[model samples]
Target chain A: MIAIHGFSPSGNCHKLRMLLEPLGQPYDWVEVDSPNGATRTPEFLALNPNGKVPVLQLQDGRTLTESNAILYYLAQGTPFLAEDRWARAQTLSWMNFEQYSHEPYVAVARFIAGWTPLDSPRRAELPRLRERSHQALAVMERHLQSNDWFSAGAYGIADIALFAYTDVAEHGGVALAPYPALRAWLARVRATPGFVPLPEPDALAADRIAQTA
Target chain B: MIAIHGFSPSGNCHKLRMLLEPLGQPYDWVEVDSPNGATRTPEFLALNPNGKVPVLQLQDGRTLTESNAILYYLAQGTPFLAEDRWARAQTLSWMNFEQYSHEPYVAVARFIAGWTPLDSPRRAELPRLRERSHQALAVMERHLQSNDWFSAGAYGIADIALFAYTDVAEHGGVALAPYPALRAWLARVRATPGFVPLPEPDALAADRIAQTA
Candidate 1:
């Protein structure tokens, strides 16, 4: 069985757990709490020098980092990935957008709100992060207005990639009220069989998020 | 023939050109000056709602965004993408690292140096960007010390994706002198068959970069 080293509240880590459940692939989950600096330790660094979750470890002990890459690895032969060449590329484009444009702002804002203290200096970054996060959401909204899914006309890894962050965006103070289409798409993703919701933040983290809010 | 809408000096766009040259594939290059607000125009947005480059338009009029995705699209079934599944996923892990960890700092630093005026407030970001850029470089250096290539144990799209920004990192005030292994890898990429150097920055951009130095 594959073992995933992950932080439960992280959208990046949730991307893998969400997909694996629906794919019916059994895997062990190793909680690596990133906020407490576990990822930076030498022991964890040996698994992934990049030191971010989620890291997928094969039963043979080889490991893979970067949540989206792990999704691609697990989904390629499955229905979660498109078979057509162009469709696969299109799916990859959205995943890249998720990592580059969306996650940086959306996920970081959520991290600041939930993981950092209420008065943390990183809170100063929220306005700009929120602005950029909205821009990314707007792009998704525009696409969703015309199409049903982010991946080659289906709810696949691209949707999974974007969904993980977007669903929890309000934790970052990014409201979904303006994007009806995007909200509908989010519901569609939830309706997928074997879907699993991201774990809620722990009590302390929730307090931070509430105070920041 | 395929048509590539790109900005010549962008590492993202150059990834496609660099690979296409070696692949002996014929394509039309439509230079879209992204630095001048070209990408934000409605027409360009039609091609890529994310309003970024490079956008690959197939002869059939299908478009693909994200430089790495375009590379994956063009490289599939070629030696550029690995045939083995695990190797292919490893390649993607590196590419994801480039976008998520490396390019956001290295490429953005370069943009601030070359595209923005020297006195622009964005220049304030340089010190931190360079610190993170070096951190990314250090990881690459560690990997290159033991391995010769980034993709499937060979020179391919992962190299191309990383090479785009790394080769121009000095423009971002990121000195390459410390990492001998990374420098050697850069040299090897340059020596690859059909390698094409990134085009020179325009006079105004060159001047901005020089002033920052």
Candidate 2:
């Protein structure tokens, strides 16, 4: 079984759950909650020195950090993965764009708006973050206008990598109304087979309580 | 021929050229100096909506952007590329690390320090950039301390992604003294088979002028 460590609240951490449910892959889900600082623990750091969430521990006992890397490992050679040369390149390109453009603004702003207290000192940066977040959405809206998908003529990890933040962008004060194409894309991804969403904190707590019992 | 649209001084652009020369691959190189506003032109923007450099155009006229993606496509199935699944995943992990952790700091700082004038507004961000650059180097130093190579037992595009900025890091005011292991890793990368250094701007210009005449 693969062990995934992350808070369910994170769009990045939830991406794997979304992918794995559709693929019918069985694995252990370990909740490394940010509120309690589980991921920063020494044990977790040993598994991933970077001390980030969504570290996948393969059955062989090797752990891989970096959310996108884990996604690639899970999707490679599967039908969900792109096959053609340039198409695969396209998948990577969007993933790159996600890290640089989308994740920085949308993801960070969401963290500021949703996860962190609004009155927290970090909220002071929200104005800059919000502006960048809108620009990111604009980029996505433009590319998605012409194509139904990010790459390979179908849905793939590129969509997954970008989708998590793009969908939840509203929590960060990004109004997606101007991006009709991106809005449509979000609906399509939500409709994808085996798509599991991040469980609300209460639902996750119930699951944990059940497991312990 | 594979046509690389790039700026001479851009480390990301140079990554492709460095990889191509080692494998003895022939490619047409087009200069795009975005700092002077060349990349803002519609013709270039059409090739890459993002207007980023290091767009690789194939013989069939398909343009692939993102320097890392281009590297993977051009080096596929070559010894410079990894053969197995795990090695490929590791290669990508480091590449992703480059984008998220290293590039934003090390590469961006290089642009400001080496290219922007002292009074240029971009230069003002250098203090913050330097802090992040050291943080990034610290991350690399720890990784290189245990492993001679980043991914797999041998070197791959992961090295190329990092080596591009890391080798020229001194230009950005990042001293190599704190990272003896990284310096050793740099030596290992340079000593690898088919390694090539960036073309001097004046030397490459002279060659271009000669070819045009």
Candidate 3:
């Protein structure tokens, strides 16, 4: 069995659940409170020097960090990943885009809104983050207008990767109403077999999100 | 032959050159001046809706975007990518770290320094960017202490991905003197077969980089 150290509400961490449940791959989940500085501890740093979450720990204790890479690894030879080299590469392209272009704006906005205090200086970043979040969503909307899935030929890890954060983008004050195609695609992803939705934010986070959003 | 649309001075664009030259892959380089708004044009957006560079266009006209994804696609079945699944996953983990953790700070700092005017307000971000760049470098230095390469067990695309910006981090005012091991690894990568150095910035950019660095 593999163990995943993740924060329950993080879309990056939730991406694993999105894939594993569909594949029926059994794994243990160890929750880490990232917003509270759990990821910055020395023990967590040993597992991933970069000090980020959603680390996949094998039974043998070898670990892999980065959510999309873990998804790629666990999805190998399964329906969740494509065997075609081009499709796999295209899938990776979307995953890379998620991490670089999409996640930073969309996920960080959600984090600032939900996890940070209302009076925190980080709140100043929300406007720019929201603007960039819309830009990323526009790109996704353009793609979803022409294609049903980001995972090349099917609903695979790429869809799961993009879906994780996009589903909760509204939590960040990034409205989904402007992107009808993206909204439709989100509905389609939710209907996939063995789908597991990301957990709701905790009370404090929920309260903060309600206020900030 | 495949066509690679890239700007000459970008580390993200340079990553493809780092891989293709070593693989002896035949690719036509169509230099796209990304900084001066080439990527924003409707014509280039047709090639990559994301409005970024280093897009790999197959002879059939299908295009793939994202620098690391292009490296992964071009290096398939070659020594540039590992054969073992775990090794490939680890390689991807590092590439993800490059785009998510490293590039946003190191590469952006370089861009703001060299491309923007000296009085540009973006210069205010340099101190924070430099700090984050060193933090990333420290993680790499720690890894390099016990490992010779980031591409799992050998020098591969992961190395190329990280090497691109890391080799030129000083251009962003992020000093490399503290990361001796990382500097050594950069030398080892430079000594690899068919290595092509990143091109020099033009006169105006060079002058800006000199002042900022």
Q: Which pairs of residues collide in candidate 2?
A: A22-A194
**Candidate closer to the true structure by TM-score (higher is better), 2 or 3:** 3
Per-residue lDDT of model 2, residues A1-213, tens digit only: 888888888888888887788889898988887667887788887887766788888889998777887888889878767878778888888888888878988888767666654346877777888888887787788888889998567988889999888887766677798889999999998898887665553544344323321
Candidate 2 chain B, poorest ten consecutive residues by summed lDDT: B204-213
For every prediction, compared with the true complex, DockQ reads 0.93, 0.57, 0.93
Cand. 2 TM to true fold: 0.91
Index of the highest-DockQ prediction: 1
lDDT of 1 by residue, B121-173 (tens): 98999999999999999999999999999997999999999999999999989
Error of 1 at A166 (Å): 0.3
What local lDDT does model 2 show for residue B169? 76
Which regions of candidate 2 fall more than 4 Å away from where they truly are?
A200-213, B199-213
Candidate 1 CAPRI assessment class: high
Once superposed on the true structure, which residue ranges of model 1 sit more than 4 Å away at CA? Answer: none
- lDDT, model 2, position B101: 80
Each candidate: RMSD: 0.9, 6.4, 0.8
| Chain B: TM-scores of all predictions | 0.98, 0.91, 0.98
lDDT for each candidate structure: 0.93, 0.80, 0.94
Give lDDT tens digits, candidate 3, residues B122-190: 999999999999899999999999999999989999999999999988888889999899999999999
